[model samples]
Target: MTTLHNAEAGDRDRKAFDDPAARGQLIRWFVSAAAISVPQAAGPVTFSLLALVLTGDTSGGAALILAMTVAQVLGAIPITRLGRNRSATWFLQGLIAIRTIALLLMAVLAAYGAPFLWLFLLTAVAGSVHGAAWGYLRSVLNGLTPASKMPRALGISATLNEVTFVLAPVAASGLGSLSPIFAVVAMAVLGAIPALLVPHVSVAPIEDTPHAGGSVLSPSILLWLMCSAAGGSAIAAIEIGAVALAIGFGYPPALAILFTVPLCLASVAGGIWVSVRNRAATRGMVVGLLCVMTGGAWLAAMQHSLALTIVGAVLIGAVLAPLATYYSLILDILAPPNKRPEVFALLRTANAIGIIFASAVLTATSLSVALLVVASTMLVVTLIVGAVSFKEKRRA
Candidate 1:
């Protein structure tokens, strides 16, 4: 009986995707995902170069990035809430337009020798919309694809995002060589593609029912969010500290790619694996992925040998997509239907917070120490998850 029901559901999912309109929207969403990801993937380098051009210091660039991240974390929920009564696609496009205008304004002002402070403020303006924009985009996905096919859809999106990260940096560097302001302009232009490309979908109105006001931050929701944060911090540590890791391994700064490239390649492979499998991970599998990531962080931190460290990086990369996809899928189930955008916004904010945590730790300590701290955090989170799961199983 269960097998028959499963087969019938699978057929329904496929038939939904078979519709020409649905397929078109999915394709558009894929392009939009890649488009938006380009700016984020290239942001650190582009902003750093912009700082160098304006103030002759890269630290200001990091500050700008921090300001943007902080603003996104602070603004995500409220901004998403404001759009509750509006069309998701329209709101998302508006947010993207706002960000694009801010980026363009910053570039124009930089050309006119604007104060670093003005540039900083503009960066914040652009970043404040990121989380809400992402939430709406995810919400749009919910409309374009059926629930049973969501894993595959998210998997494809993840794969594109990984590819964007792989290429965006190189593109930024190439464009930055001409002019950092030009690179910023290009980033803004590409980032705004989603504004134009995102297809319109009918948004169901949230009826004024009591359950519509349910809290989005239940303990179960927090558990998955904490998992996301831990994973983000662990990954950020490696990416942000890649140069340090290379130097400590007796390689030149230019060879930082030795660590970063392998990690990215592994991540792309992982994304592909998730797309091919197209299934949600079980609780035990989620816990196991967490353990693998924790072990990877520890191994990379050990810095005992170059080969070993690269191996560790690969391990961390290997589980990234599976875990990320699981978080999205599970959170969709846990969040209140009416408050989904807020929950998804918080999901993104959580990861941003994790990046901020990793950045702070790296600034205050050595790369080795930072990685250790990240690893330790992941370990603690993993144990907590394990304990909670054990209790749940016992109750069952």
Candidate 2:
């Protein structure tokens, strides 16, 4: 009789774990988090254009972006630490509120002709809080998702995020056509939606234990971080120089939209594939994808034809979301359970650094040369990571 009761209890627990309502709430939270990323994904292009409009110079835009990236890197750790003991839902709501208010203030300032310096300061403020928002969102998802379902949940989240990346800039550009200030205001309104939805989400309590996993500086984590950085730099290089590439190919600058739309569509498809597979990527697969991505970058940079450019874009985009999904999965394996939020923040910091690196190179060289540099960097880093993984496997 006791054995039967034990079996029944186990079945009950398993059913609870697989509850459809719980999964539905998780999906809702994921959608809300992705919605928040829309404005963030649009930020670089919007701020850059705003800077150009206000100062009649591109350097102003670069400075604004630099300020934001620097602040985000510096603030990620402390902000995450502050929220470490709080309810995940409450913490996320607070961060979203801060971000919404900052963007609204930015819109007001832009509408009223605020000074460039003020705009830069506000951008930095918004960005500092923004890093923690992403960290907490990931943490919330971690707490809500079962280990067995993590890869699928993260894959779906990544796909939605790719959708945001695809639409945000296009939306910003469309709104900016009428008024850049209008774009800022619209993003501000969109930013508040997540805050309203956070209260309905539930998270499992994560036990704060010391015996979680290896440090973020461990070889596995470092290798994944480097791969993430390289991928980010490659993507940033393409995004930041798309307009210039369009002009270089004798097309109108507005045709830059053509480069991004196809790339994003392919990314969405790749993300869906990852979700459906619901499996973690192996080291061999990572290396192979990086090689493909590098080859695509080279093709895009070397070929001047519009047709080849679009093909190259598609090739790179096809691998990007899958690569990101793999990295998140690897990070889950490498990071301590208790350290997930901060570790995720560190990944964002690494990506931000890569963006800064690409931006600096673009400022110093032609778009083609900068792209070659991006591709070369990715190739070198990927080869090093592959070697490290091979060595580790051999030792194992």
Candidate 1, 187-304: lDDT as tens digits: 9999999999998997432222123335899999999999999999988999999999888878899999998899889988888988899888999999999999999999998998
Which lDDT value does model 2 have at 104? 81
| Model 1, runs deviating above 4 Å | 1-11, 203-213
Q: Candidate 2 has what TM-score?
A: 0.88
- Encode model 2's per-residue lDDT on 1-396: one tens digit a residue: 979966775665456458887766676777787887766777766776776777777677567668878888899889988988877668878887887788788878877888777888887887887677777777777556655566677778878888888788878888876777778778777776778765344444232213347676787788878888888887788777889988888889998877878888888898888889877778788888988888878777776688887787888888887788788767766677667777778887888878888888998998889989988898798789778878978999
Distance from true position, residue 306, model 2, in Å? 3.8
How many pairs of residues collide in each model? 0, 0
TM-score of each: 0.95, 0.88
- Whole-structure CA lDDT of model 2: 0.77
**Clashes in model 1: which pairs?**
none
Best by lDDT: 1
> Can you give the lDDT of residue 26 in candidate 2?
77
